[model samples]
Target chain A: MLSVESLSCRYGGVVALRQISLTIAAGEFVALIGANGAGKTTLLRAISGLTPPYEGRVIFNGQPIERASCAQIVRAGIAHCPEERKIWPHITVQEHLRLGAFGRKDTKEVARDIDRVYAIFPKVLERRKQVCGTLSGGEQQMVAIGRALMSRPKLLMLDEPNLGLAPLVVEQVIDVIRAIHRDGTSILMVEQSAALALPHADRAFVLENGSIAKQGRARDLLQDPDVKRAYLGEEKQGRLIQDPLAKDPLATTR
Target chain B: MLDLLPQFVFNGLLIGMSYALVAIGMTMIFGIMNIANFAHGEFYMLGGCITYFIAAKLNAPYLVAVPVSVAVVTGLGFLLERVVFRQLRLKSAMSSVLATIGLGLILQNGALIFFGPQPQAIPTSFSAFPLQLGPIFTTEARLFAVAVTAATLVLMYVFLNHTLYGTAMRATFQQTEAAALVAIPIDRMRGITFALGAGLAALGGALLGAIFFVQPAMGATESLKAFIVVILGGLGSIPGSIVGGIFLGVAESLGTVVSSAYKDAIGFVLVIIIMLYRPDGLFKKS
Candidate 1:
């Protein structure tokens, strides 16, 4: 559904993404796991047309969309929910949804989809008239997802949906993600949590310094000693903490 | 003293009505575009010219003349937006100010070339008909000006509140990028808003010309007064401009009654005092 070849992104002289290449098949659920500054967000931005790559080709759904405007790319069926959740502060929940469906013209269906989103996220429906700024972290995240869904995107790309939320809320969000995937939307997700993402991701790619370090089925990568040491954190062996906050023991190999 | 009070109030209301029509559109532009439009008064002058040519020379009725003036001025505003303002493309207010200042000079001089520097009065069927309520007297022209301004204001309010485009415009005023992202066609809205503002300014000028006098430089003084009203009203608040205009009209009227020489200065001083006490006007309570 999406292809990237020789993608390199730079912020001034500093390279944020370097010589990256990856692909996602139609209807695939792919998780890209990375440490901080792993070029995950940069990769997403380039594909989503928020940031252009210094050198590369990005083709989605058989069209070269590397030069399309942000709105055009979104209308082309890729919805990007950034990590920070850039919800308009003063606008209401319904207004945010309306904005998400901005470029779309299917009036009746759009209204129906809003209802569907409300059904999926009862909390958002309850506070439909409330301003988005006042919602809790999890509720705001729901609104963000609901907004993306309003676009009726083919690929819903989420960057760190679990950031700064309670574990229970994360579980709730993950469940929503799973349901969204089951309902037939191809998803490309980036997660800091290795184990949680690994179990759900059909195919997983490890991004290190803007390049793919490793790729395989979730289960095989989960069992590899290197993957364990680098991402899984040698937890089963009790040699290192797998926690995201702790330093990985695999740095000795760096 | 009691008998004369009605005269002062009627006169103040007449001036205030003109101020309100012009200032509402100015506030709308400021609120949405954040540009003060230094050439607003020129548009007013253009409106008067259009009205004069249509109603007086072409023998069209006054009712027909008003809309033609508004339409011509609005079209001119749209052309200015597309040719100049849109090219500026999200520039700072200072840039808009400089551009408008230049435009103002051009417009005023252009008026000089075509219409000449002299004032023109409408040659109606009959002239100087007076209406007296007790001892207070007002001309037909002033009374018509007052009535038309109030009617236009009501229409403007309805256009702003009830229409989809109007709501979308309001949304843009609050947050431009967000409004654009929502497919509001922001550039189109901006151009339309500028045209609307210019149209209203022209209408006000035409009205003033009928009741008072018309000249190439007529819009300059009232434009300054309008600026004062906008500031006193608050930068981007429409309702504030109306209240601020009425207050200024009353203050100016009282100053005239007390002493006509210091009246302009007094109106400006009142604005300063109000600003010193409430910087963002009465609307921006937050």
Candidate 2:
């Protein structure tokens, strides 16, 4: 339902996404795996119209959207759950969900959809009135995803959904993602962790230095010797490693 | 001296409400647009000038003129936001600051040319007779100003807390990028916010124009007081601006007991003390 052809994006003199192309069919779960600064975020930003592309086209359901504003792109049925969760510190979780549907005119369906989101994340329902800043990282991540679902998009683009999340929490989030995919919404997820994403994706594209290095079925890429050596082997070594500074202690205080 | 204290406090409350009205608008513009909006005072000046023209020149009633003036200033605000502020949105904050300051100068001078330097008073139906309330006394116009300001404040609180647009505005204030991601028409929101802020300032000017004289140069002092209130209350905090405005007004009113010449200086001194100790102001947004 979405196609990006030979898209290129630049930041000042530096090229962030260079001649990249990808596609996702209806109900497909695609994973874009890349290292830090590999232009994964930039590609998503370009698609969502946050960053204007220097060249190429982004066609959503056969309509060219590279020139559309971020708001227009969202109205065209593409929801981008941006990096770092981007939760407003003082806004409540329920308000975040309502904000996700800001452009929709169906007040009745919007209210129903908010309840639907809560059903998907019961923890979010419990803290609907509480501000997001007070929530745990895992709860915040759930609220972010729930907020994205509030848009009722045809294509949901998730950028680093598992970033800074604990292993157990990551598993729960991935499971929820799988359930959502099973319910028939297309997802294009960007992840630095190949092993975490590949197992759940139908297809995968390995990105390197702003270009696509590999693209195929997820299972084939999982067994590819080079892919195994670079992504999976690294995962095995640091399976227990957790960045202590990922969660700020003072975040809740603010 | 003690008997006169209540009267001083009552006078302070009257002026403080006006300050609060202006400061709230300033704070809202700063919070959402990320612009200090040096031209904010111009909106207030235009509010009073427009009211004067409609009421005094056109022979319209004061009540009819106030809303008309607010609507006119609000329309002007939206036009300026579209033509001037939209272009400066992508530019640096310093550029916006300079642009607004220049805009303020042009507006001030424009008003000077149009209205001239003569001060004008809005003809109100309120009686000039002072009403004694136990140990305190105040004129009808002053009472009307306070009543209108308090009602405006309550209305503002309800609009902001209970409305969808207000929630979206608050969300935009906290996270612009996230707000856009959710398809909130952020540009439109900014324009509306700028207009709303302008309308608010105009309301203050209209109400106060009845109590005090409306001159082309009145905005400068009003703008200065707004800045002091914003800083004293904490930059983007609405409640802070309200409390800070009253504090400044009361302090300045009480300062007249010692020396009326130094009344304006009192707000500056309080602001200096606030900056030294609580740089974030009294109510930092949580």
Candidate 3:
């Protein structure tokens, strides 16, 4: 479980996240949706301890992780797959996976987990010996997720898993996230595509300008008129969920 | 003429041994830590001084004096890393340059105050008898230096190529952040890198002390030679260092045969011309 309380963070004088607070239970898929520069990435970076916060604290499993080093955070079972896909280009995919489990000492368990990840993403397994630099963008994303899984993390935080992938690749990746959560791993995903995120998330939070604009169960929020006018934008609205009254609700928005 | 070629070849090989020894450490340091340690040649002088004191004054045996000189200078390197290099850890390249130059100044003055700026020699007492290579006669001292230098260099090659830590250092050199993320301990690797560089410098200097007069300032000339070797070999390339070193040594020796005073000048001229054409040096790139 994770608890974020009144967290405020800044980049120089520009505020990135301000007094944004939320919580996630173990084994749940909670998506944070926002437009570009809406502080989703900054919030995740702050949680992962790669970025220092200006105010407030983060508690993971009853311990404060505000000042913990990135290594320390990983050791504490939180793996963050940054948006940049920061894989070592010259090192092989297997080597990247090995580095993900750097702090782990049990060789047997580590080997077992690597096998588990390989089974989950067979493309990464096929390209195990190839240098990660040569991997396709979708394959690279798979390698990144598989790498985070190598850490055996309790919470896997991913930023924009569908950023630049083809539509087919994006569908496959979102399916992977669903399957990963169903298998008992907690996932905190941030994406600009609220429609895609809403279908899989048990609960969701809409972020606007560094603060939580709304939070509720995904199904109820999907049918809300304000959620449509502000975020869903009614373009392909029928694809998400069929609310009979939701059609007129889009026009009656205050 | 065929017989005389072998003689010159033997001469070149012995001198190449010394060149390789000095340049190996230089290349390792520059490759990983990215600093030249302008004070490296002075480490060679320190080794020579230790050998001189232990052998000439304490009457220690030659065999004992050689390793002791190396160990003493190695300890000095470890100390310098701990006391000095650590301070400059987060500093820019300029800080490293200024700090090392200051350290070099300190070392130079320390040697002067203690050794009185005198040129001294360790009484090697080794045989001056020359082993004939067809038409040429090479002395025992030069042969020892050449043999030791070759053996050390081969060991260095193995360490850099085959071992886990060696591969890790090379990895760190290529990509620092990636290395750190994998818990390779970048700072610790740098310490080993510096020690390795300093130890080899001492070994090369001690070997040279057998033939040249061991003086407080001997590092000056040897450092110049080592710098030329690094430049010629190409920066940060291990094999390049060796090839460049031998090439420079042979060129200088041949230049000496023509006109001894212009040997260093010729090496410089070639270095300038080569750099203009190919700044990277003559080694396979990373």
Score residue B173 of candidate 3 by CA lDDT.
68
DockQ of 2: 0.78
- lDDT (Cα, tens digit) per residue for candidate 3, span B216-279: 8777777777787888888878888888888877777666666878967977897898889878
TM-score of chain B of each: 0.94, 0.97, 0.94
Q: What is the TM-score of chain B in candidate 2?
A: 0.97
Candidate 1: segments with Cα more than 4 A from true spot:
A2-58, A64-71, A80-102, A129-148, A157-181, A187-254, B1-10, B90-94, B122-128, B132-147, B254-257
Please write out the lDDT profile of model 2 over residues B231-264, one tens digit for every residue.
Answer: 9999888888899989889988999999999999
Q: Looking at model 1, give its docking quality level.
A: incorrect
| lDDT string, candidate 2, A151-172, tens digits | 8988899998987776667778
Question: What tens-digit string does per-residue lDDT give for candidate 3 at A194-225?
Answer: 66678789888988899999899988878877
lDDT of 1 by residue, A1-254 (tens): 88888899998899998888888887889999888788999988888776778998998989988887666778788888887666655557887786678678887888899999999999899999988878998899999899888889899898988777666677788899999999999989997666657878888888888788999997888887877766765554422233443243222111
DockQ, per-model, please? Answer: 0.23, 0.78, 0.20
Cα lDDT for residue B238, candidate 3: 84
My TM-score estimates for the predictions, one after another, are 0.75, 0.94, 0.74
Model 2 chain B worst lDDT window (10 residues) = B158-167
- Candidates in order have lDDT scores of 0.79, 0.88, 0.78
For residues B1-286, what per-residue lDDT tens digits would candidate 1 score against the true structure? 6677778877888887777767777787777777777778788888887788788778998778878889999999999989988877657678987898899889988988888888998544435868786777998788778878888888877776555566567667766644543445677888999999999889988887777767788777767888888888887777777787777787787778888899889777877887898888755533
Shift in Å, residue A181, candidate 1: 4.1
